[model samples]
Target chain A: MKVRVTVMLKEGVLDPQGKAIGHALHTLGFPGVEAVRVGKIIDLDLKSTDAQAARAEAEKMASELLANLVIEDFTVEVLG
Target chain B: MKVRVTVMLKEGVLDPQGKAIGHALHTLGFPGVEAVRVGKIIDLDLKSTDAQAARAEAEKMASELLANLVIEDFTVEVLG
Candidate 1:
Protein backbone atom coordinates (compact mmCIF):
# COMPACT_ATOMS: atom_id res chain seq x y z
CA MET A 1 0.00 0.00 0.00
CA LYS A 2 0.96 3.56 -0.56
CA VAL A 3 0.40 6.15 2.15
CA ARG A 4 0.63 9.91 2.14
CA VAL A 5 1.23 11.94 5.24
CA THR A 6 0.76 15.69 5.15
CA VAL A 7 2.28 17.51 8.09
CA MET A 8 1.33 21.11 8.67
CA LEU A 9 2.02 23.58 11.41
CA LYS A 10 -0.89 24.27 13.71
CA GLU A 11 -2.87 27.44 13.31
CA GLY A 12 -1.44 30.40 15.25
CA VAL A 13 2.10 29.07 14.97
CA LEU A 14 4.43 31.44 13.17
CA ASP A 15 5.83 30.20 9.88
CA PRO A 16 8.85 32.24 8.90
CA GLN A 17 9.56 30.23 5.78
CA GLY A 18 6.03 30.76 4.57
CA LYS A 19 6.29 34.46 5.21
CA ALA A 20 9.52 34.55 3.25
CA ILE A 21 7.90 32.75 0.35
CA GLY A 22 4.98 35.16 0.42
CA HIS A 23 7.34 38.09 0.41
CA ALA A 24 9.20 36.67 -2.53
CA LEU A 25 5.98 36.11 -4.40
CA HIS A 26 4.96 39.71 -3.82
CA THR A 27 8.32 40.87 -5.05
CA LEU A 28 7.85 38.76 -8.15
CA GLY A 29 4.61 40.56 -9.01
CA PHE A 30 2.06 38.34 -7.26
CA PRO A 31 0.39 40.96 -5.15
CA GLY A 32 -2.85 39.03 -4.82
CA VAL A 33 -1.32 36.41 -2.59
CA GLU A 34 -2.58 37.28 0.86
CA ALA A 35 -0.92 34.53 2.87
CA VAL A 36 1.14 31.40 2.48
CA ARG A 37 1.63 28.28 4.57
CA VAL A 38 4.12 25.58 3.76
CA GLY A 39 3.94 21.97 4.81
CA LYS A 40 5.54 18.59 4.20
CA ILE A 41 4.14 15.85 2.04
CA ILE A 42 5.60 12.43 2.76
CA ASP A 43 4.75 9.54 0.52
CA LEU A 44 5.45 6.08 1.86
CA ASP A 45 5.50 2.83 0.02
CA LEU A 46 4.42 0.24 2.56
CA LYS A 47 4.51 -3.49 2.38
CA SER A 48 1.02 -3.68 3.83
CA THR A 49 -1.86 -4.52 1.54
CA ASP A 50 -4.81 -3.48 3.68
CA ALA A 51 -5.88 0.14 3.51
CA GLN A 52 -6.96 0.25 7.16
CA ALA A 53 -3.66 -1.13 8.37
CA ALA A 54 -1.72 1.16 6.08
CA ARG A 55 -3.51 4.23 7.38
CA ALA A 56 -2.88 3.19 10.97
CA GLU A 57 0.78 2.55 10.31
CA ALA A 58 1.18 5.82 8.48
CA GLU A 59 -0.49 7.69 11.30
CA LYS A 60 1.89 6.10 13.74
CA MET A 61 4.80 7.13 11.57
CA ALA A 62 3.53 10.69 11.39
CA SER A 63 3.01 10.98 15.12
CA GLU A 64 6.28 9.36 15.98
CA LEU A 65 8.68 10.89 13.49
CA LEU A 66 7.03 12.90 10.72
CA ALA A 67 5.27 15.59 12.77
CA ASN A 68 5.95 17.52 15.92
CA LEU A 69 2.95 17.15 18.15
CA VAL A 70 3.51 20.46 19.88
CA ILE A 71 3.29 22.60 16.75
CA GLU A 72 2.24 20.36 13.91
CA ASP A 73 -0.72 18.29 12.84
CA PHE A 74 -0.67 15.52 10.29
CA THR A 75 -3.16 13.71 8.13
CA VAL A 76 -2.55 10.21 6.91
CA GLU A 77 -4.15 8.85 3.81
CA VAL A 78 -3.78 5.36 2.41
CA LEU A 79 -3.54 5.07 -1.33
CA GLY A 80 -3.84 1.39 -1.83
CA MET B 1 -9.55 31.73 -3.00
CA LYS B 2 -7.38 29.04 -1.47
CA VAL B 3 -4.82 27.38 -3.67
CA ARG B 4 -2.71 24.33 -2.95
CA VAL B 5 0.48 23.74 -4.82
CA THR B 6 2.20 20.40 -4.37
CA VAL B 7 5.75 20.35 -5.60
CA MET B 8 7.57 17.06 -5.96
CA LEU B 9 10.97 16.16 -7.29
CA LYS B 10 11.01 14.69 -10.77
CA GLU B 11 11.38 10.95 -10.94
CA GLY B 12 14.99 9.73 -10.95
CA VAL B 13 16.21 12.80 -9.11
CA LEU B 14 18.17 12.23 -5.94
CA ASP B 15 16.26 12.93 -2.72
CA PRO B 16 18.67 12.75 0.15
CA GLN B 17 16.16 14.19 2.57
CA GLY B 18 13.62 11.51 1.76
CA LYS B 19 16.26 8.83 2.02
CA ALA B 20 17.33 10.14 5.38
CA ILE B 21 13.78 10.17 6.60
CA GLY B 22 13.28 6.61 5.40
CA HIS B 23 16.42 5.52 7.11
CA ALA B 24 15.36 7.17 10.30
CA LEU B 25 11.98 5.53 10.13
CA HIS B 26 13.60 2.17 9.70
CA THR B 27 15.84 2.81 12.65
CA LEU B 28 12.79 3.78 14.67
CA GLY B 29 11.05 0.46 14.02
CA PHE B 30 9.01 1.06 10.85
CA PRO B 31 10.34 -1.93 8.99
CA GLY B 32 7.38 -2.10 6.64
CA VAL B 33 8.25 1.17 4.97
CA GLU B 34 9.71 0.17 1.65
CA ALA B 35 10.31 3.58 0.20
CA VAL B 36 9.79 7.23 0.98
CA ARG B 37 9.55 10.41 -1.07
CA VAL B 38 9.22 13.88 0.33
CA GLY B 39 7.58 16.87 -1.28
CA LYS B 40 6.32 20.31 -0.43
CA ILE B 41 2.73 21.37 0.05
CA ILE B 42 2.16 25.05 -0.13
CA ASP B 43 -1.15 26.69 0.69
CA LEU B 44 -1.88 30.14 -0.62
CA ASP B 45 -4.62 32.50 0.38
CA LEU B 46 -5.40 34.46 -2.74
CA LYS B 47 -7.57 37.50 -3.14
CA SER B 48 -9.18 36.11 -6.28
CA THR B 49 -12.70 34.73 -6.00
CA ASP B 50 -13.07 32.93 -9.27
CA ALA B 51 -11.91 29.31 -9.11
CA GLN B 52 -10.85 29.24 -12.73
CA ALA B 53 -8.77 32.34 -12.42
CA ALA B 54 -7.35 31.19 -9.09
CA ARG B 55 -6.25 27.92 -10.62
CA ALA B 56 -4.57 29.73 -13.46
CA GLU B 57 -2.83 32.13 -11.12
CA ALA B 58 -1.66 29.33 -8.85
CA GLU B 59 -0.35 27.40 -11.81
CA LYS B 60 1.52 30.46 -12.93
CA MET B 61 3.02 30.90 -9.47
CA ALA B 62 4.08 27.25 -9.37
CA SER B 63 5.79 27.50 -12.72
CA GLU B 64 7.35 30.88 -12.14
CA LEU B 65 8.64 30.42 -8.63
CA LEU B 66 7.35 27.51 -6.60
CA ALA B 67 8.93 24.72 -8.61
CA ASN B 68 12.13 24.15 -10.49
CA LEU B 69 11.05 22.90 -13.92
CA VAL B 70 14.34 21.13 -14.43
CA ILE B 71 14.04 19.05 -11.27
CA GLU B 72 10.52 19.32 -9.89
CA ASP B 73 6.93 18.95 -11.03
CA PHE B 74 4.09 20.77 -9.40
CA THR B 75 0.32 20.46 -9.26
CA VAL B 76 -2.04 23.31 -8.55
CA GLU B 77 -5.47 22.95 -7.01
CA VAL B 78 -7.90 25.73 -6.22
CA LEU B 79 -10.11 25.38 -3.19
CA GLY B 80 -13.00 27.75 -3.64
Candidate 2:
Protein backbone atom coordinates (compact mmCIF):
# COMPACT_ATOMS: atom_id res chain seq x y z
CA MET A 1 0.00 0.00 0.00
CA LYS A 2 1.02 3.59 -0.67
CA VAL A 3 0.46 6.20 2.01
CA ARG A 4 0.80 9.94 1.63
CA VAL A 5 1.45 12.07 4.67
CA THR A 6 0.85 15.80 4.53
CA VAL A 7 2.09 17.87 7.41
CA MET A 8 1.48 21.53 8.14
CA LEU A 9 2.26 23.93 10.90
CA LYS A 10 -0.49 24.25 13.43
CA GLU A 11 -2.68 27.32 13.45
CA GLY A 12 -1.59 30.27 15.62
CA VAL A 13 2.08 29.50 15.01
CA LEU A 14 4.02 32.10 13.05
CA ASP A 15 5.66 30.77 9.89
CA PRO A 16 8.66 32.82 8.90
CA GLN A 17 9.21 30.81 5.72
CA GLY A 18 5.65 31.49 4.65
CA LYS A 19 6.13 35.20 5.20
CA ALA A 20 9.27 35.12 3.10
CA ILE A 21 7.47 33.27 0.34
CA GLY A 22 4.69 35.88 0.35
CA HIS A 23 7.27 38.65 0.07
CA ALA A 24 8.99 36.86 -2.77
CA LEU A 25 5.74 36.40 -4.64
CA HIS A 26 4.98 40.09 -4.34
CA THR A 27 8.46 40.97 -5.53
CA LEU A 28 8.02 38.66 -8.47
CA GLY A 29 5.01 40.77 -9.58
CA PHE A 30 2.30 38.53 -8.15
CA PRO A 31 0.89 41.07 -5.77
CA GLY A 32 -2.52 39.46 -5.92
CA VAL A 33 -1.31 36.63 -3.72
CA GLU A 34 -2.13 37.44 -0.13
CA ALA A 35 -0.44 34.75 1.97
CA VAL A 36 1.55 31.55 1.68
CA ARG A 37 2.02 28.64 4.05
CA VAL A 38 4.64 25.98 3.36
CA GLY A 39 4.26 22.41 4.48
CA LYS A 40 5.70 18.92 3.87
CA ILE A 41 4.59 15.75 2.10
CA ILE A 42 5.97 12.30 2.72
CA ASP A 43 4.95 9.42 0.50
CA LEU A 44 5.65 5.96 1.76
CA ASP A 45 5.32 2.54 0.20
CA LEU A 46 4.52 0.00 2.86
CA LYS A 47 5.05 -3.73 2.65
CA SER A 48 1.65 -4.46 4.09
CA THR A 49 -1.21 -5.17 1.71
CA ASP A 50 -3.96 -4.13 4.11
CA ALA A 51 -5.20 -0.55 3.82
CA GLN A 52 -6.15 -0.13 7.46
CA ALA A 53 -2.89 -1.63 8.64
CA ALA A 54 -0.84 0.53 6.30
CA ARG A 55 -2.59 3.70 7.39
CA ALA A 56 -2.17 2.84 11.04
CA GLU A 57 1.52 2.07 10.56
CA ALA A 58 2.08 5.21 8.51
CA GLU A 59 0.36 7.25 11.16
CA LYS A 60 2.77 5.85 13.67
CA MET A 61 5.74 6.86 11.54
CA ALA A 62 4.27 10.28 11.04
CA SER A 63 3.60 11.01 14.67
CA GLU A 64 6.86 9.56 15.91
CA LEU A 65 9.38 10.53 13.23
CA LEU A 66 7.71 12.32 10.36
CA ALA A 67 5.99 15.20 12.15
CA ASN A 68 6.47 17.38 15.18
CA LEU A 69 3.24 16.85 17.05
CA VAL A 70 3.92 19.93 19.14
CA ILE A 71 3.45 22.49 16.38
CA GLU A 72 2.69 20.49 13.25
CA ASP A 73 -0.41 18.60 12.12
CA PHE A 74 -0.23 15.63 9.79
CA THR A 75 -2.78 13.68 7.80
CA VAL A 76 -2.15 10.20 6.47
CA GLU A 77 -3.78 9.43 3.15
CA VAL A 78 -3.83 5.84 1.99
CA LEU A 79 -3.36 5.83 -1.78
CA GLY A 80 -3.65 2.16 -2.34
CA MET B 1 -9.53 31.85 -2.67
CA LYS B 2 -7.38 29.05 -1.34
CA VAL B 3 -4.95 27.16 -3.57
CA ARG B 4 -2.73 24.27 -2.64
CA VAL B 5 0.37 23.30 -4.55
CA THR B 6 1.91 19.87 -4.06
CA VAL B 7 5.43 19.52 -5.38
CA MET B 8 7.38 16.31 -5.74
CA LEU B 9 10.75 15.41 -7.11
CA LYS B 10 10.86 13.94 -10.56
CA GLU B 11 11.02 10.17 -10.80
CA GLY B 12 14.49 8.53 -10.61
CA VAL B 13 15.93 11.45 -8.73
CA LEU B 14 17.89 10.67 -5.57
CA ASP B 15 16.12 11.48 -2.31
CA PRO B 16 18.59 11.52 0.53
CA GLN B 17 16.13 13.05 2.90
CA GLY B 18 13.61 10.35 2.17
CA LYS B 19 16.22 7.69 2.65
CA ALA B 20 17.24 9.21 5.95
CA ILE B 21 13.68 9.29 7.11
CA GLY B 22 13.21 5.68 6.11
CA HIS B 23 16.30 4.71 8.02
CA ALA B 24 15.08 6.53 11.09
CA LEU B 25 11.73 4.81 10.87
CA HIS B 26 13.34 1.39 10.66
CA THR B 27 15.64 2.28 13.49
CA LEU B 28 12.57 3.08 15.51
CA GLY B 29 11.30 -0.52 14.86
CA PHE B 30 8.96 0.12 11.93
CA PRO B 31 10.49 -2.34 9.49
CA GLY B 32 7.21 -2.89 7.70
CA VAL B 33 7.70 0.44 5.90
CA GLU B 34 9.36 0.03 2.52
CA ALA B 35 10.23 3.27 0.76
CA VAL B 36 9.65 6.96 1.40
CA ARG B 37 9.57 9.99 -0.88
CA VAL B 38 9.50 13.48 0.54
CA GLY B 39 7.82 16.40 -1.19
CA LYS B 40 6.52 19.89 -0.45
CA ILE B 41 3.18 21.64 -0.16
CA ILE B 42 2.64 25.32 -0.62
CA ASP B 43 -0.70 26.85 0.39
CA LEU B 44 -1.60 30.21 -1.03
CA ASP B 45 -4.43 32.53 -0.16
CA LEU B 46 -5.18 34.62 -3.19
CA LYS B 47 -7.22 37.76 -3.42
CA SER B 48 -9.06 36.64 -6.54
CA THR B 49 -12.57 35.28 -6.09
CA ASP B 50 -12.71 33.24 -9.28
CA ALA B 51 -11.61 29.64 -8.93
CA GLN B 52 -10.21 29.45 -12.44
CA ALA B 53 -8.27 32.69 -12.02
CA ALA B 54 -6.96 31.57 -8.65
CA ARG B 55 -5.70 28.27 -10.09
CA ALA B 56 -4.05 30.02 -13.01
CA GLU B 57 -2.36 32.53 -10.75
CA ALA B 58 -1.27 29.82 -8.32
CA GLU B 59 0.13 27.79 -11.18
CA LYS B 60 2.18 30.72 -12.29
CA MET B 61 3.54 31.24 -8.80
CA ALA B 62 4.36 27.54 -8.56
CA SER B 63 6.24 27.27 -11.83
CA GLU B 64 7.97 30.62 -11.50
CA LEU B 65 8.92 30.62 -7.83
CA LEU B 66 7.53 27.74 -5.80
CA ALA B 67 8.82 24.82 -7.89
CA ASN B 68 11.85 24.05 -9.97
CA LEU B 69 10.71 22.76 -13.33
CA VAL B 70 13.91 20.81 -13.87
CA ILE B 71 13.64 18.32 -11.02
CA GLU B 72 10.22 18.97 -9.52
CA ASP B 73 6.65 18.50 -10.70
CA PHE B 74 3.87 20.52 -9.04
CA THR B 75 0.09 20.31 -9.03
CA VAL B 76 -2.26 23.15 -8.21
CA GLU B 77 -5.42 22.30 -6.29
CA VAL B 78 -7.85 25.17 -6.03
CA LEU B 79 -10.01 25.19 -2.91
CA GLY B 80 -12.82 27.61 -2.37
Model 2 agreement with the true structure over A5-45: per-residue lDDT tens digits: 99999998899999999999999899998988999999999
Clashing pairs in 1: none
lDDT of 2 at B49: 98
lDDT of 1 by residue, B1-80 (tens): 99999999999999999999999999999999999999999999999999998999999999999999999999998877
Chain A agreement with the truth for model 1, given as TM-score: 0.98
Q: What is the TM-score of chain B alone in each candidate?
A: 0.97, 0.97
iRMSD of all candidate structures: 0.4, 0.6
True contacts kept of each: 0.94, 0.99
